[model samples]
Target: MSGVRLVMARHGETAANVQHMLDTRPPGLPLNERGHTQAAALGARLAADPVSAVHASVAVRAQQTAAPVAAAHGLDVRVVDGVHEVFCGELEGRSGRAALERFMAVYEAWWAGDLDARLPGGESARDVRDRFLPALDGILDGASGDIVLVSHGAAIRLAAAALLGDTAETRFLPNTGLVVLRPDGDGWALEHWDGAMPVAGDVTAGGTPA
Candidate 1:
């Protein structure tokens, strides 16, 4: 049976991302200059495909990132709260270096397959996976043609891990990177990861944007 194609891309860089800050709060800052360029590039790349839908996290950066692509495809950008970045809680608005240090500590535990280890007042990796996968499953079940999901790094990583049936370490997707998955039976199959940007005019077997 033919299955749905899910094209997931990380949001463009934000001012916080460029300055190495932790932006976990609502209405966080918008994208920086380079971030706008990146989003434009991503939109140009995605224009080659027939994107039936564009979904984004509700964060300012993510919404800004999805705007260009949605406009290019003539699709309304739907904000899905479920795909928001993991809540950093106390770490919100902290410097990126501090967040990195803390993230590394959490990552170490994640590498050891400990899903419960979490930053203070934040969701665990397992928590992210649990929330995101079901949302993704619903998207897949109802979607046809090509669907573009613009989301944060951590949430996208957890969802990719769930789809690929791998640990967190196996799911390192770069900012603005693209991961394409196709529904397979009751699960999903990873068709490509960090593949060429669609601007290069590369189309996958399932006609998804990469």
Candidate 2:
């Protein structure tokens, strides 16, 4: 395993999540009660690991989700601008079956490698990759041990598929769910995807003991 393990986590359920609303603005929305619970559970689970750094999107929800984990490790949550949720543009605050359908369509295009597709007045897949991958690379370059990056679900899904590959596991990350990746030569290899942590291990490389 590589010394630098990356844990990409989706923020816990928010009121927006429950309503299926799209809220992408920075310093955006707060988490509801259920989201707090999920965040706590995720934090407790990660407390057992040797996480050295905690990075989160600038969005309020992402910072809120990362709070418990950062507190547990006595680490400050570093807000990275690039990891913020995709700017929804015309879709912001829109909710309903039709809105969701449209959102998913654009998302599917991103997964299919249509990097230029975007919502009206919004960002394209390439825009996300441009900012997100560089921020991720910066984190990896600076970290010596395990790292936790708390971000939005769609953002993580798209970036993971772009950086790793377009696959089922890379398509969606449940709220508070996480995936583990370690460097494999020039790229990254997925070690775990929304799965249980190993019951025993060093907990540094971000994988369950085999």
Candidate 3:
């Protein structure tokens, strides 16, 4: 407990999540009723965990998800633009199996070390890393204790994998799931992930969007 710990949480469920739509970008869909419940549960789960501050992406879902957690600690949800979801571009708003398949294909390529692979009219893995990692650095800069960040599924998976030097299979981070990291030298050391340390195995689910 010498240095600070960083918690990257995937936002709660949304209508876009239930319908499997590509809802990246700001002002995206808010959390559904179930999502609000999940957010509150997330807050209760972390209420006793000392949190120095709460940060979220510009997307409404991310901000909304961070609210209860922030309120629990008497803090406000600080929105950071660079942590937004990886834009789906031409794939925006589509929810068919084919759309998700194509999106997963590119994302898996990134986990397989193809950071240059770009989504169809969307962002490259490298593009996500560039913005996401720096934003995390700024959050952790001169901080202590724990910091909570609520973000999207794919973006969290992509950025977390890079930060932990992991190439694990590209599975979506379930709603409110946390990826914990601690400052290790100039980089990071994976402390906890999905309730365990980082693993190399693949975890499959419905091909979900970021």
Candidate 4:
């Protein structure tokens, strides 16, 4: 516990996410209705915590996702471009299942620990790690208490894998899921991971005050 406590959470579901489409960047599609609900629930859950700073990817979805929690804590959301999603390039708006199947071969290679394998015109795990790890390091360098990071699914997974010394598959996270990490000397310690919102309550939504 010599370093900062990082709470990493993925953005809630988007229209593209619910439709199984790939969304790499912004002006990304907005969160669908279910996504709104998820965001609200997540905000409610995090509202009880003491968050010093809230950072999110510049992507619209992530910014939208970070809104509620940041507002609840009276903290502004800092857009960290370095923490954006893995660039999917050609696969940007393709259907998720199709993208998965189309890139299955390449994905398998990457998942098998290649780390440098990239999908057609897309970023490799190593590419994402390069951009994201430094941003993460910067956060830990400045942090004194809990900090929430809202980012994409793939980037989150890879970072968690790197932090936890786990395989890519073992580190994958679902949309809007929460993953907690505490610093331990040169590395991090996994605290808790709740990838889904709690089943009860009236979760609030949007960047607007509720």
Per-residue error (Å), model 4, residue 200: 29
Candidate 3 colliding pairs, count:
0
Best by TM-score: 3
Model 3 C-alpha lDDT per residue in residues 1-210, reported as the tens digit of each score: 356999999888888887778888677999999999999999999999989999999988888999999999999999997898888888899886777778778876776788899888889989988999899889877888899999887788788778767744434468888888887886678877763322333222532554
For model 4, how big is the CA root-mean-square deviation? 6.8
Q: State the lDDT of candidate 4 residue by residue for 37-86, as single tens digits.
A: 88888889989887888899888888888988898899899888688877
**What overall lDDT, based on C-alpha atoms, would model 3 receive against the true structure?**
0.82
* TM-score, every prediction: 0.85, 0.88, 0.90, 0.86
> In candidate 1, which residue ranges exceed 4 Å CA deviation?
1-3, 96-98, 167-171, 195-210
Q: In every candidate, how many clashes are there?
A: 1, 0, 0, 1
Worst 10 residues of 3 by lDDT: 195-204
Ranking by TM-score: 3, 2, 4, 1
True-structure Cα RMSD, model 2 = 8.0
Off by over 4 Å in 4: 1-3, 166-171, 196-210
Better of 2 and 4 by TM-score: 2
Superposing all C-alpha atoms, what RMSD in Å does each candidate have to the true structure? 7.2, 8.0, 3.1, 6.8
Off by over 4 Å in 2: 166-169, 195-210
User: Per-residue lDDT for 1-210 in model 2, tens only?
Assistant: 368889998887777776667788787778889989999998999998989999999888889999999999999999997998888788788876666666667766776768899877888888988999999988888576789999986678667776676664553467788888888898888888884432332121121000
Cα lDDT of all candidates, in order? 0.71, 0.78, 0.82, 0.73
Q: Looking at model 2, which ten-residue stretch has the lowest summed lDDT?
A: 201-210
Write down the TM-score for model 3: 0.90
